[model samples]
Target: MTPDDERFDAKTTVLIETVGHHVQEEETDWFPKVRDALGRKELQEIGARMRDVRATAPHRPEHPGSLRAADALLG
Candidate 1:
């Protein structure tokens, strides 16, 4: 099986919902223009950016006041 299948486990329903939302974003704001304009290299760059964001995503909820108190607690 693929890594995506393993990462998004049965209990992680929210991840599926989040992917649906991202698909909607692409449909509304990106796919039409991108389908015509962007090349494979540009698409690769976008994928790389998304990977970087996922790698450094915030794991813990940040409190309102402190800037550094509740930073990304992820590994």
Candidate 2:
């Protein structure tokens, strides 16, 4: 591969690994702590509220901040 292609592959690997780690940490660590703190009844209520919000929420983010962050990282 060309140097540019190799650089892109490395960057993609880092981005994917970072996202995977964040998801794993959030699910395996943070979510359990939140569940323990909030309990099931509260979580169920929150889940219902979340479902309602998700039904109406825009599929894409409304804010440009996320794009800016990604650009800052990748550009």
Candidate 3:
């Protein structure tokens, strides 16, 4: 494999590990703290605000080759 291939593999491994750690922390610690702090009505309001933001957000253009590359990787 090329040096670029090796670097990409390393970066992908780091990204997966970092995301896994963050997800675990959110599930085990942060989420519980948030649930305890925010009442149901407040949580519902926050969700509504998030939906509004998502509805109004502008679309971002993807790199020309990225979708094909991603499909190839997953295919």
**Alpha carbon lDDT of each predicted model:** 0.67, 0.75, 0.75
Off by over 4 Å in 1: 1-25, 59-75
lDDT agreement of model 2 with the native: 0.75
Candidate 3 positional error at 68, Å: 30
lDDT of 3: 0.75
Model 3: residues with Cα > 4 Å off, grouped in runs = 1-5, 58-75
Q: Model 2 Cα RMSD, Å?
A: 8.0
Best-fitting candidate, scored by TM-score: 3
Global CA lDDT computed for model 1: 0.67
**Better lDDT candidate (2, 3):** 2
TM-score of 3: 0.68
Q: Give the alpha carbon lDDT tens digit for every residue of 8-45 in model 2.
A: 88988898999999999999999999988998898898
lDDT of each residue in 1-75, candidate 3, tens digit only: 464885888888888999999999999999999999999999898777667655544455365665554454345
Better of 1 and 2 by TM-score: 2
- Against the hidden reference, what TM-scores do the models get? 0.38, 0.63, 0.68
Off by over 4 Å in 2: 1-8, 62-75
